[model samples]
Target: MSSTLKVGILGYGYATATFHAPLINAVPGLKLVAISSSNATKVHADWPQLQVCSTPEELIARTDIDLVVIPTPNETHHALAVKALTAGKHVVVDKPFTLDTAEAHDLIAHADAAQKLLSVFHNRRWVADFLTVQKLLASGQLGRITHFESHFDRFRPEVRQRWREGAGLGSGLWYDLGPHLLDQAICLFGMPQTIYVDRVLQRDGALADDWFHAVLGYGELRMILHASMLVAHESPRFIIHGTKGSYTKEGIDPQEDALKAGVRPDAKDWGVDETMGRLDVMRGTWMQHSQVANERGDYTRYYAAIRDAILHGAPNPVPATEALQVMQLLEAGMLSAREGRLIRLHH
Candidate 1:
């Protein structure tokens, strides 16, 4: 293997163009070498030097590529990742790792058999608000958190003609944004004991579910994860209440917006979020409120860790096992919604 891991992305869609390619290129020990896209011109318009393959199979078969990043649709992740792993390349699949836990397990097994690293792009873990929440929790300022609510709501009333909003197997708000919220929650609190979900199609012409509310129970703690397409008002991105205090944050991470605006990940203020979170805690006699500065988010760290894991045997940043757990929760959430009952997790 070369000192730099050559990467080939499986698609040229929004995720591939917005997050994966730019992040891979920004990392030091990784190279965005090739991309499989039908429209080579579109890929070349941004990365003129990249090798654009006509098909994912061709890209996976390349002898020079050491890593294949699958940022394609949720349904295609399993098959493409399997092919890449079988071809002896490290694989990174965008989140909602696969449609279900079964596919996630299959991919993990394939990577193990091929002696390759497998990772999922749960990049929200590096978001500024989430990072701040981690620090605040670790500091024990919130005491023992009893209630946590996370929202990824948007105001898109009109449904678009995209695969993500289609009635396909893996198309819905739950599969689209559920992985991110679930992964972040799981990171803060381990796997929940039970999960209950309510999924709905709120948009007028929506074919897939556009809104979802999920509740994950952890003993006495109740964690709520919600996303909707019809919310116009400002909603707290994160709200946590503990025995000693409470914390509330507003606004989503800025990295995605920056990336969408063609901002390079190497910029000085790459992941700097200006929105401060309000931390209210009891200090002796009275309650005090203070603004907590956010920690800088760096999605490039994920790819960099992937580079080190492949070349230097460092731990995988977002290992297949961790993502598989997220998949389990996603599947369980669906079952809960379908059966209208709380689903219990075994492990």
Candidate 2:
């Protein structure tokens, strides 16, 4: 059963094209059997060997498919995942697990009942910069974290026609980038005490939100998640501070760009951030500043973990429950933004 984990993807959009397909094909035990896509030409061009189905129904129902990956629009995740899980196939839903926390809970219950593995594609947790921070925080080098900031900003002047930019529950910068930032926060610090958000359509004539700034409060420690389309000079990926020192990291993870450029995930020195982070730590009584060496951020680690969980029963890399917490934080942000008030998370 080593090579019997045939995986079927539920969409051929950017997420599937750039991330899921490439990463699935890269892993050893996972085989790309079929894909759900309307664009046969583009799908064929991307993978001539793989079978392309017109709809997700055809792909998820295949007897040979052991795993089903849904990288479709955020709104359709719950429905597709339910169908796949009920079909007795392991399910992988992309981030922002579902449009709402209720939908996420239902999916989790369905997956648990089906006894099939359910996971989310929370790939940002594998970033090299984040890994470094994890090491620092775990080592107690950053004593009593006071503030942490994570940004996923970009400069998109013209809001191209896309489902994410359209008017919907899962559309907007908050839904798009919020999951990534929040997942990272939850990984380090569990649920926050309060959530505050400021969401607006900053871009001229933009339909949905083009920018968002959220604050996750944990007593004295506050985590900031910010993203925008109008940022010409993108901010650092992470800005972290504690009682000991501050770590300001610049540059996004190279894996996504490398995938878009047709570079293999296992290429020479993959996931290595060329531009390292500036580390300021208290040495004795004074603070010393230096460049911290970055750990290689390999996204394939996620797929590998999935394979192990399916075949060898290893723990899931991004379990459904962890993704659920991210969903809860997202909903809290929405409530905060809608009411123009700070939403306190009891747990």
Which digits, one per residue and each the tens of the lDDT, describe model 2 over residues 139-216?
Answer: 887688998998888889898899999997699888899899899888999999999999999887798998899998
TM-score of 2: 0.98
Tens-digit lDDT track for model 1 on 135-176? Answer: 999999889999999999889999998899999989999999
Best by lDDT: 1
Say which candidate scores most in TM-score. 1
Per-residue lDDT of 241 in model 2? 92
CA RMSD of each candidate after superposition: 0.8, 1.1
Task: Assess every candidate by TM-score.
Answer: 0.99, 0.98
Provide the lowest-lDDT 10-residue window in model 1.
Answer: 24-33
- Provide the overall lDDT of each model, using Cα atoms, as 2-decimal numbers: 0.93, 0.90
